[model samples]
Target: MRALRRWWHDTAGDLPATFWYLWAGILINRAGAFAMLFLSLYLTEARGASEALAGAVVGAYGAGGAVGVLLGGVLADRWGRRATLLTAHLVTAGLMVALALSRHLLLIAVLSALVGVVHSMPSPAFVASIVDMVPEQRRSRAFNLQFWAFNLGMAVASLLAGVLAEASYLALFLVDAGATLATALVIAWKVPETLRRPARTPRGVPRIGSTARSARRPGLLTALTDRIFLTFVGLTFVLAVLTMQTSTIMPLAMRADGLEPSAYGLVVALGGALIVLGQLFVPRLIDRRRKGFVLATSTGLMAVGFGALAVADELAVYLGAAVIWTVGSMLAAPPNAQINADLAPPELRARYQSVFYLTFPAASFVAPTLGGVSLQYLGSAHWLVVGGLGLLAAVGHLLAGPARERRVAALLRGTRNGRPATSASGPMPAGGPEVATDPVRT
Candidate 1:
């Protein structure tokens, strides 16, 4: 008990009031996140749309998200983080009501797309806000707390959604709208804007925000050219793909193997429960470990989890695999966020976050299509292939993790020496193109 108390205190110090509010707001929004989970069913069964049209409409939501994330990143940098979130949430609230009231297929589709646009636009800013709220050392713990709350809300929502979905989806939409609006109000009232805007700096004196502005930012294109960051994005996307397999393919495999739908639900709920309980414990325990080690371990667990399902027949076995992957997911997430935040300079913070946030939509867009195709073609053998892919991702992260550390350290060294940071190559000479400093992030 003494040891546990000490660890908890160490992992969680006093955070800002705004951070707590942010946490609460995120929890509320995620709890009512019922629409996307049930949208397909609503379109097809509830509204009597053809499968193809329903798919197109669903696709519209995702398309909007893809666009929204990019737009959100720009908006965060251009406007402020709190402002961007306020706008996004307000619009999302309005759209949820509009979607609930929407009866005609055309109107529903348009509103859905619009909803997607605003709905996803807040992601980069939201993550950025968390980073801004916490100090360097507590970032992983902060992110883990946020991540845990998100999944907790999701788990609760998933359970309630089925029960509520049986009655009226309108109730679901209204609740969702209410929660989002309340969250918007919380941000509008409580959370301060965190984005550093460009302002005129004196010739010699350096203001903090001004220094952020003067970092010779190469814009989104320049951010894209960042070798270490780009590599991180690629690896994150791969991890997202593995995660998608759990959602898309795992269910299909379970049903194909004669397990009931409830079996999958039970497995998912159990996984969520594990995350809610273990998220805080795992990251704190492993906080001292290298990011690469965490990433590698996560990928290895994913490989093993999926590999286990490929052979297991019992529900017990399936649930065991679920637990393994859930722990793996929790372990990898905070480090990933920490790394992304570390990679960006204050000037390019939002844009870098947006680019990093691109992994989700990118993975979302690709994963379903690819997994569906693979499952359809490979029949029973696809799980093994996925496990093999996870193994490859593990190897990739192990290699990339160390390489990322080297680059960040070198960049920090360069910055301390009054030189701009170099790319992921050898030691940069003085006055070389400078990079923003990032030490031990990711």
Candidate 2:
């Protein structure tokens, strides 16, 4: 108890208003997502939709998310973070209300897409806000705190939603809509702007754009074309594929094994509980380590966990697999953001984050459909195939050895040479710090 007290005291600090506001909003919004707990069941049992149709509706959400992420990045870069976030919440709130009122399949699909779009809009801005508020050293801790808070909220929401669904599905939507409105209100009133714009040149001097055009230096597209950044994005794509298998197929597998809804709920609860506990220690374990090494190890652990799931039939075995995956998830969460933070210039941080985040929506788009198809065709053996793909992605990271180091070195060298240390074009110089060193604790 004394140690816990001391830890709390030491970690206490002022976080950005945006962080608290967003965290609160997440908690509220997630609490309302109780409907998601039974969305598949609702569509299949209540609404009488085909399995393929349900998958399409769910997958369409991902499609909308992809579009939202790209647009959000550009808007956050151009308009500012606060505005983008506020707009997203407002739009999402309306969509939730619409979804609650409608029953037509096509209308539901459209509303789901809108919900997905607005739901994703705040992510880039929110993540960029964290990067802006915290120092590099503490960034991982800060992100971990955010993840912990998010999962905690999710766990609560999932439980409550389940309870509410047993009462009324429409009630779940109404509750969720209310939460979204509350979130939007908090953002509008509490969150501050965090977007960092580029410095303007003197009136007589040619604009940086004109100069870059003359010099033939590459632009944002060219900078993103970097081998390391692209590699990380590719690996994240694979991780997304593996992780989605749990949400998409695991429940089906559990049902096949004779687990009831309550039992399946317990399994999800356990995973969330593990994440909350694991986040507490994972930051300390990876303290001051290279981001790449942390990421590689996490991905490898995830592969092992997924592989275990392929063979496990007993509930205890499934729980054990969840524990392994939870650890990997905790490790992977912070460093993923850290790497993107390292790669992006201060001015373009939000844009880079938005683009990097594209992988989530992209993978979401592919994973559900593929997982469904695989399960329909391959049955239980599909787990092996999915786990194998995760292992392959982990191996890819291993083969991409020292790429992070090389990228950092190049970034530092470019900075030292004063070669327009911008992210719109050009490579990061070498020999700089590999991981961000500041604590994001607040």
- Total clashing pairs in model 1: 4
lDDT of 2 by residue, 361-400 (tens): 7776677666667766787777788778877776676665
Q: How badly does each model clash, as a count of residue pairs?
A: 4, 24
Model 1 alpha-carbon drift over 4 Å, by segment: 1-4, 40-59, 101-110, 198-218, 246-264, 307-317, 376-380, 412-442
Candidate 2 global CA lDDT score? 0.68
Alpha carbon lDDT of residue 351, candidate 2? Answer: 65
RMSD of 1: 4.3
* Model 2 Cα shift for residue 95 (angstroms): 0.9
State the weakest 10-residue window (summed lDDT) of model 1.
433-442
> What C-alpha lDDT, on a 0 to 100 scale, does residue 273 get in candidate 1?
88
Q: In model 1, what is the error at residue 54, expressed in angstroms? A: 6.0
